[model samples]
Target: MAALHELPSQMRAVYLREYNKPYELVTVDVPNIRENELLVEVHAAGFCHSDLQVIHGQFGTKLPIIPSHEPAGVIVQIGSKCSGPWKVGDRVGVLNFKNACAKCVGCSLSQKRYRNLDPRFCDNRETAGFQHDGAFAQYLAADPATTVLLPSSLSFEQAAPLMCAGATVWGALEKATSGLEPGATVAIVGIGGLGHLGVQFAKALGFTTIALDSRQAGRDLATEVPGGLGPDLVLDSTASDAAEKVLAFTKGEGVAAAVVCTDSIVANTWTLRLLRVGGVMVPLGLPPDRWQFDADVLVFRELVIRGSYVSSAESTRRMMEAVGRSGVRSHITTVELDDVPGIVDMYQEKNFRGRLVVKMRD
Candidate 1:
């Protein structure tokens, strides 16, 4: 293995020793890099809603695990078997899936969306934070194949949320925005963590983006784009005339697509009314209960409802490029590693703005 310097034997980490419990701060051994892996000294890791699901026994009991799959940091070591336009000290973000299985989130949509993924990678992989130890620590052993180089201009905190939140939304938008004509319109429903990013991506990807949300903050964030270029319109999903407003915006045809980013069954089911015929609707949230939709709308409109679990490594790189070109950025609130447990409830609140990230070190 190639390394920058003598590595530390131990590091501080947040450990999930049990389900439905607060993560505990503890010391653990720094991971060693494999020939095809990279040892990253994590600078920032994003706290996602999925992380809360993990703690709530959503993915089953994989006890004594480190949380936070959204990892961005400096590569401190590279495995001898790893080769690319990379070396130690490069800033990087790791795709959580080690080797995507067909049933896994990556392969579920990445194969069809990107068409660059291998079927051989389908069905026998471990996912970071779920099946394998993830980046709630100072260091992470990342698979080189699933890692992307980060832009030098982006901070680790800024880049960390993009690893999953940004990539997942970008992947979902890719499903609907592909081949879209110029001036085509898309609506981002529930502009929260992922939805807010979806608005920027849709606008950047050549679609007339319309932001829809129940909360004023989320709707407000939709218009908070850098360079004074925000979504074309913003609507409160909870508004009585929300659906009518969209229909009117698209001249009674509706948007070219509608991405429902909230887990609200109401949003998931109602947003279907806003898609044009043959439009796509990607449910980006993981709701606790089943989501019911109108079957007649599905058959008549031919609306494409697809599942986008996460994005491929190549697609993630594409998203980074979009970030550069569009000046899209995550509205982040940083907290030290030790402060994570205390703020878990804060992120769970409805008024939480932007992403909550853990700043591991300088």
Candidate 2:
């Protein structure tokens, strides 16, 4: 148990009191820890577009919930029955999926590799920022099994977004680049939170990275520093011959892999055209509409289309370790916990750059 002095009974939080309504600042009691759980004192939380979708009732969310999934913090209290490696004062961040059942048939099929795809999935799974009360507060109750330790070199602000955005792209990139050579061409479409990270990871893995985006900022960020953390090439998806440009650049062969990070149907459709024969297309973004592709192209080219969600805990840890060692980090804008409501407004308006992390301690 944590000393009473170390924690308060009530903490400040932003609550989604109703669907399609603005968040309200309120004081709520700190969440109780269950067996196999840790009580984390949140240092920082990351605002995700998924949270915005929930606020709009896109996920049919339950009311009066605390939102924000990307949370990094220190463990203050451990449940009596907790048996994992967790301890008080340990730095940790929450994973996208929490409380997954390890006994499902899907778990048996993938041998625990793709439990998130189990038919019985979500029956026992609790998702942070979606199906459960999340980290938009000073404290969060986390499953030790779903929490990742942060490296000493990573700050709370930098580690928060890695829990979700970084992990999602890492998983997608891993799938996209599987069985491909290091020098193979990889295209990251969208150049947003997930897309940007995909570019970084692809570049780090020694692949020639190509970034696809319609925005000048995306093209700019995809340039190598002194310029930025950029790709080897950038394709402007807005151009009439954008697909043709990618094909021409690849000598009419297309890239080895195209990771679609945007939910835009157009962007998703473009992934098929941007890949070489037998190349994999990984779509990680959730657009509000169904993605349409040419069946003839898919059949003739023998292309692969796969959807990747949040990564496994093991993958997340590996990504964090790599980020710490390689100096890979997310571009973030920090805000106070009280600034969450306005942050949501900015997200809806698409006015921010990179990720927005909320500092709860200040």
Report clashes for each candidate as comma-separated counts: 1, 2
Q: How far is candidate 1 from the true structure (C-alpha RMSD, Å)?
A: 2.7
- Expressed as tens digits, the lDDT of each residue in 2-51 for candidate 1 is 78899989999999898878889999989877687889999999998888
RMSD (CA, Å), candidate 2 to true, equals 2.6
lDDT of 1 at 308: 76
Error of 2 at 40 (Å): 0.9
Q: Best-fitting candidate, measured by lDDT?
A: 1
Cα error, residue 336 of model 1, in Å, equals: 0.6
Model 2: per-residue Cα lDDT over 84-111, one tens digit each: 7776889988885666576665556655
Estimate the lDDT of model 2.
0.81
Scored against the true structure, residue 64 in model 1 reaches a CA lDDT of: 89
